[model samples]
Target: MAEPQPYESALDAIPGAHPYPRSSRYHDAEVGIHTQPDGTAVRYVKRRLLPPLGEADEDIATHTVSSGERPDHLGQRCFGDPAAWWRIADANPVLDPRELTAEPGEEIALPDGFPGGGGRFGR
Candidate 1:
């Protein structure tokens, strides 16, 4: 069985609510190599912050946040995958998740009606 994640994932109730090192967003970047004095090259892989996906002409739905919500939770509820939380952020584009769902009665845009954020997400 899959563990139940909160709608507002950044909520304090969830254990380890924050992603471990901001999740796998850095996997896209190439690793850097450092030359050592002993003629050996040490390779280091650092996590990279990616540019946010922009909003486009896509069908969407509204979700009323009731405190303790996270993008992953909404994504899971609406798109069936927690990873799709970024979609919520993209639709709303709040600099911080806290601001996205700050109040208990705040409303955020939830993508629905198609796959992959309503399909054909433009760059």
Candidate 2:
């Protein structure tokens, strides 16, 4: 019925708000803006490039997918934290996390130890 006010996400209300944790793949992504012909400003996050699969291959460990295995659970089993599942995704070629354990008896590579301690993460 009326013009909308400028959009400021709830997270923007908090000073130094960071939606992604340091361990997240998006932690270092940059924010970008685009302008329409009407001059309205649109903000968005820039595309994030995935690290090459081999980056996480250092000190690699393998786990055979069992029936009903989940990525979060696999992350916990491999890296001690379910939230670190992306680490597993980064080490493999699959674009979807679910594909990591979609088939029973499939082998997946995992980077051992802290993300950046020796692995290529935290770059």
Stretches off by above 4 angstroms in model 2 are: 1-16, 112-123
Q: What's the distance in Å from true for residue 22, model 1?
A: 18
- Model 2: lDDT equals 0.69
Give residue 111's lDDT in candidate 1 (0 to 100).
54
Task: Give one digit per residue, the lDDT tens place, for model 1 in 1-123.
Answer: 133375543454456453332223332345778999999998776655433333333565666887787666666676566776665675676887567667878877665432234422221
lDDT of 2 at 1: 14
- Candidate 1 residue pairs that clash: 7-70, 8-69, 8-70, 9-69, 9-70
Cand. 2 TM to true fold: 0.66
- Tens-digit per-residue lDDT, 1-123, candidate 2: 132244534544566676565556676688778998999998777998765556545567777888998999876766566787887887778879999999999998876543432332222
TM-score per prediction, in order, is 0.46, 0.66
